[model samples]
Target: MAVLLHRLGLGAYRHRKLVLGIWLAVLAALVTCAGVFGGKLDDRFTVPGTESQRALDTLGRTLPEASGAGAQIVFTAPEGHHVTEARYTAAIAGAEAAAVKAPQVKAVMGPNVSGAVSADRSTAIVQVQYSVQRAEIRPSSLDVIERAAAAAEKNGLRTSVGGSAYGSNGVHIGPSEIIGVGVALLVLVVTFGSLLAAGMSLLPALLGVAVGLAGLLALTPAVSISSTAVTLALMLGLAVGIDYILFILSRHRRQLARGTDPQESIALATGTAGSAVVFAGSTVIIALAALSVIGIPFLTVMGLGAAGAVLVAVLAAITLLPALAGFAGTRLTPKSGGKQAQRSAAPDGSDGRATLGARWVRTVVAKPLLTVLAATGVLVALALPAADLRLALPDNGSAPVASAERKAYDTVSDEFGPGFNGPLLVLTETHDRPGAQAGAKAARELRDLKGIKAVLPPQPTHDSAQTVIQVMPETGPDSPRTARLVRDIRAAAPGIGEATGATVAVTGATAVNIDVSDRLSDSLLPFTAIVVGLSLILLTMVFRSLVIPLKAAVGFLLSVGASLGTVVALFQWGRLADILGLAHTGPVVSFLPVILIGVLFGLAMDYEVFLVSGMREEWVHTGAARASVTDGARHSVRVVTAAALIMFTVFAGFFPLDDALIKPIAFALAVGVAIDAFAVRLTLVPAVLALAGRHAWWLPAWLDRVLPDLDVEGTRLQKASRVVHREPERVS
Candidate 1:
């Protein structure tokens, strides 16, 4: 692998223009094609076999009009006035006029026309049914309805809109990317101390991110990826892209400072650091690919998109970075003669020198148990909030207060009831007259059930073989009470279905969220076990140690737990909700843990491989555990911390994104990377390795014989160094 990468780097350095041109061509092609063929991205996920999905399928086949997205134009009359008053009549009139102007609208049921009014007569709902699913409705198509709502508001009545269609406005790139880039530029310049070198590391990464996003957009027509997938891709792409470049660039500059020729330095760096880049990137790709095992389409697309971005970033690092390095010449080297300059140029603490990184390692090694205990205590304290962690889909309760959906939710909950915001549909399939009669009887009985606010009359389908009953619960969708209510309804469904000789399902927006929450919770254990197991196997192969992989796995879980617990405290428990502008305290996004586990686990392994591989290399060469620990930490600390800082910044930039879903993801990744870098990688890993001593490298003889040897650091580059030096023994 070292020889092959060395040769490739040599070729790229020799034909630098050609290599650069190929990347540029790829970028141009991606941009042009994606622009022409790109389709809109959305989150139109449905869990197969879930009651909500079953209800949708049945509706699509039997009552096609009912299958499309439904929007509620909620209206509230002025103080002490009823909706039937003439003052509110203009608002309804304007809405009716707008409905007539709107396209793809199947029907509109107004309060005056259909008598859909609240019990207080102060609130009324105008139900607009569209001809297509919410996923199929473009944001622009909903603007006509919005304009009508605005016109209605001009009257003496208060008006708001809510539904899946109103919920999805056009998604745009937020200021987070720009903010991330600005911060990255600062970190790169400070780290490299050379404008040309800093730009070299950053430019290729930005281009790779561009290509990745373009390719992802181009895939939208062929594959329906979630809209948020693009944001996630951008966040991850920038991070890995910059970090990959940082790895190779730092190594190349170190070789240049050692008086190696530019081309040779680039080759050796690519052969060594580039190999780690490949391994780390592959680990991330494998981890993300495991998301497919969950059997969720949106999640599969998200994983694929993120993995593809990482792949592009890796390719750019190995190919474009080396080619660009050829033009950098001596500018990659730090200036000589000053204290700061000397320290910056000292990549590996030469002349048996002890740098701060080395000093910290020694201090930790001196009292490994105490260091480990302190770090573990900090992580445990942060993770304590996770004991109360709750998971649910982000509903209107979590949406922006000014958003149409939130406003509509507030208006409806205040005027009609909170239950009116998310009504459950009780669907029953029957084959005989007695069955339909029994279904009606069951619907009437639902009114007497606890937590149910109202049970609408059962309406039979065209064939009279199916009956649909709307059941309104007392609580909102995000409430724990709502989830309990759903469970109660489902439990009672079996007995009712049996008595009616029919199949009954609890299906609605709230029901779908419950189903998703249950699936994510159930799948969390198996999914985590699989990812952790795979990471263990991979780390074991690279480090050639049982104890090493076990420790790394524990550290990874600790970082993940601490990060999630922080999210729970801030977002779920609302410890600082008012300051963050959160609408209310509620469950974390249902899929957040699943997404965080995949991303954070992969990122954790990235640091693990980079740090441990260096230590393992030192241990192999010197046969001294403490010296290797100190040496490796001193050598890799700057690069890993810099990489972590860049990643944290990139993720933090996403805070400007208005989407409730994207914010939690951004927070999790940013906090996770911070904890992993500072607490786990720097503090816990060294301490644990120091205490483990020789056992850190211990693998059973038989296990070693059976396991394939994978040298991620390209140690065989020592032989290649001999060829470059023209001396067999002076390879180093």
Candidate 2:
């Protein structure tokens, strides 16, 4: 691999113009296609084979009205005022009439409808039923609904349009995203110390991200791409792109400072660092692509989208970065007597003054047992909050506080009851016509359920073989009690069927979300085992050490545990909510843990390979475990620290966005990267390696022979280079 990468890098560098032009042409083509072919991003969360999904699909086939998206135009009258007043009633009636006239609006129930007005008459909800699913509901249709509600707002009523159909799931790029890139550039500048070098490091990464994202968008017309998936792809692409380029660029500059030929340095850096990049990126790609095994469409899309972006970043790092280096020639070399030059000239890439990584590793090695205990204790303390972690799909109630959906959610909770926002549909299907009696019996049985707040009369379809009954729960949608109620309803379905001669199923927006959450929760354990097992095998292959891989896996778990705990504490438990700008806190996003494990596993392994490979290389060359640990720390610590900060900054940049879906995921990745890179890989890893001594690199001879040599550290390339240098070139 190293030899092939060396040849590829040399070819790209020698043909820099062609390489640069090829990337540019690819970028242009993708961007153009995206502009022409990109379609709307759907936010639909569908889990096939779930009971709720099956019921919903049946309704879509038999009774379209019940399966279509529903929106609520919640109106709240002023304090001490009543919506029963003639003017308020008239305005709400006007909105409902207008809503009915809107395209694709099948039905609009006004405040005059039974149970539509609050008991105190201070609030009313005008329900608008669309003839399409949430994803298919046109924006213009929603616009008409909002415009129609203007009359109610003028009548001294607070009007908020919200519901399943009003969800804002479009990917919007804001100042925060730009600021993240800016911060990443600042990190690059500081790390490289040369503006030209910094810009060069950032350019290839940006180009790679552009191509990746553009390609993803271009496929949106054919695929049901979601906003969350795009945001994740962008986030991962940018973070990894810059980090990959930085790794290779930093290595090239180090070699340049050592007075190596510019072309030779580029080849060597790409061959060595680029090899690690490929191995590290493969771990991430494999982990993400493994999402297919879960059999969830949206999650599979998210994982594959992110994996595609990372793959592009790796290609750009190995090919485009070296080509760009060829253009820069010797200019990237640090100036004589400069800080970088002086540091690079040292035996361990540090000047007379010891680097912080070196000093810290020395302190850690001096008390390996204590270091391990202290680090583990801190991680354990942070991980305690994970025990309290709750997972749920976000709903209107989880929207930004200032959003219309949240306002409507709050008003409905305050007036009509929280359960009104997420009513469960008890679907009853009979084998024959005139099944009204069975439907009525099913409704009667549902009313007797423990969590039942109210069971509406069954409304049979034209054939009378299917009946839809609305069952409102006592608690809110995201409430644990509501999840329990969903299970209770399903459990009671069999008894209801036996008593009424009708097959009953539970489905609604709320029930579907509950099913989605349950599916993700059930899949989490097996998915984690797969990821952890993959990590063990991959790390073993790269480092060729049983103990190191084991240590790396343990360190990964600690970082993941601590990261998840922090997310639970901040986002779920609402700890420091105000400081973090959280509008509301309840359950964490259902898929966050799965995503964190997959992404952070790859990244944790990235740092693990980069750090441990250096140690292994030094150990192989000198057979001095203790000295190798410190020497490796001194050599790679600066690049690793810079890379982690760049990744953290890029991810943290998305933390402040108003997007409920993107915000928590970004924060988790940011926190996870920081903890894994700094605390585990740098601090705990060195301590463990120092303590393990000669045994740290141990591998059984039989096992070693069985495992193919990956040569991620470029040992073969290093020996080949030495052989070439020993034999002088003959003029032909």
Question: Which numbered prediction scores highest in lDDT against the true structure?
Answer: 2
In candidate 1, list every pair of residues with a backbone clash.
none
Model 2: clashing residue pairs? Answer: none
CA deviation > 4 Å runs, candidate 2: 729-732
Which candidate number would show the highest TM-score if scored against the true structure? 2
Give a tens-digit lDDT track for model 2, residues 627-680: 999888888988899999999999998888887788899999999999999899
Clashes of each: 0, 0
Please provide, for model 1 over 1-732, each residue's C-alpha lDDT reduced to its tens digit, 9 standing for 90 to 100.
766788888888888899999988988998888889877776765677787878967877765555667788888888899888886876787797787668788778787765668888988988887767776876666888888888887887888888656654344565666878789888988777778878998999988999899899888788887777887888898999999999988888777776778888888888888888888898888878888887767778888889999999998998888888776767777666533256545656333466566677778888999999999999999999999888888766567888878888788888767887787888788765544686687797677679998887776665577777878889887778888988888888787777667778888667877787888888899988988898889988888899999998899889989998999999888888788766667789888888898889878888987888888888998899877887877778878888999999988888667678888889899999999988999889999999988988899999999898777788878566857587645654
Candidate 1 residue 426 C-alpha distance from true site, Å:
1.8
> Alpha carbon lDDT of residue 607, candidate 1?
90
Error of 2 at 199 (Å): 0.7
